[model samples]
Target: MDQAIQGKIEEALKGLFTAVSMLQDAYPGKPFTPDGRLVGDIGEVVASLAYELTLNEGLTKHHDAVTDDGRNVQIKTTFGTSLTFPVHHVPDYYLGIRMNRDGSFEEIYNGPGHLIQAQLSGRKATKTGLHGGLMAMLKRINQQVPDSERIPKR
Candidate 1:
């Protein structure tokens, strides 16, 4: 990356981290979990910007965003190994994103909801049970799509 571009990326990341920290302090008792929903929100923002999708705000029944081609996408984020999907309400597509500790994406997986559900049908719904098989499924799905449709590790 160009030095100037790298500098700008660092500045933006610093701002994001500062804002998350402030929110954590302001809402200390809120149930935002380990990082106060910072990681998940950042992952959504990254996916929205990268994939050029409109993010759905407020309460939604299933999906997080709609693609330019009108596909309903459910976005899920994890630090390294875990991914959670709603068993009953599946979207048209599921976007599994893994983020680094610094909030940058480590990998991205886009696949149909049915395929993912099939893979997890008789398995435990935990990180240890789901990580390997889900990752393999993502890899196969990624291979079937164009480069623009997938985000590989950096």
Candidate 2:
């Protein structure tokens, strides 16, 4: 289980980088920051999309970047359709950065409602019994799409 979670965290980080690059390309010269909230650049956006990594004896808070304005961004990444939701509500907006087999990235949006908002604002999105549902959903999505087209570089 530890290895699996670590692998997921590594994959998430790689994907986060790709998403950041895409955001930078899209925004051009705009400065991105990650302060209190992962706010600012595309990299920060990618960081925001990441999940909090829990290891054997440590907790890793994954985030994007911070700006002088004090706004944090959660960049949710995926390889396929932007229509897919998250396995957890750890982010604010779902910035879908679909990666191509040829080493390219595409940015898309899935909207922000329950996922990040609920967690950040002290709302509940699911119960303990329903935890497996997200894993199942992600697994199904993985089975449906080609590995080469997944957003992050896994």
Candidate 3:
């Protein structure tokens, strides 16, 4: 990475850490681990910005985003791991995103909910057990999407 770009990324991460720390301080009882829910939220935010999708912050059935074309998108993100099956609700499409340790996107999978569910149905829920199969499916799906549909890496 360029020195300037690296510096910018470091600055952004500091800001995110400060924000999360403030939230933790405000709500003492909540579980806000950096590696858990925080990363997931960051992933969602990144996806929303990348795809220009509208996020549903309130309680919703299944989908997290609504596209301009009226598609309901459910985004599931993991850190180089497989997403668990039997999500609370099913959406029109399932978007599986894998993030790097630094919270940058590594890969993305977009496909029908049923197809993704079927592919992951019989797998063990643990990260170690599900990673291989999930990655394979994600790679296949990733290839299907046009470059226009994907977010450009900065």
Whose lDDT is greatest here? Answer: 1
* Model 1 global lDDT (CA atoms, 0 to 1): 0.64
| Regions more than 4 Å wrong, model 1 | 1-36, 124-137, 144-154
lDDT of 3 by residue, 45-135 (tens): 7677666467788646667787766678777787545654343334576677876545456655775666666656665566333334366
- Order candidates by TM-score, high to low: 1, 3, 2
For residues 10-122, write the lDDT of model 2, one tens digit per residue.
Answer: 57656756776788899989633222222123222233343232111222233232222332333443343332333454443233344432323444433332432333344
Angstrom error at residue 108, model 1? 3.5
True-vs-predicted CA distance for residue 91, candidate 1, Å: 1.7
Sort order, lDDT high to low: 1, 3, 2
Per-candidate TM equals 0.62, 0.29, 0.60
The candidate, 1 or 2, that scores higher on TM-score is 1
Superposed on all Cα atoms, model 3 deviates from the true structure by an RMSD in Å of: 7.3
Judged by whole-model lDDT over C-alpha atoms, candidate 3 comes out at 0.63
Higher lDDT: candidate 1 or 2? 1
Tell me the TM-score of model 2. Answer: 0.29
Q: Can you give the lDDT of residue 91 in candidate 1?
A: 65
Give per-residue CA lDDT, model 1, range 9-118, as digits (tens): 55776776677678889998763344426556666777776665778886476788888767788878876566666655556877888765454564556757776676
Error of 3 at 25 (Å): 23
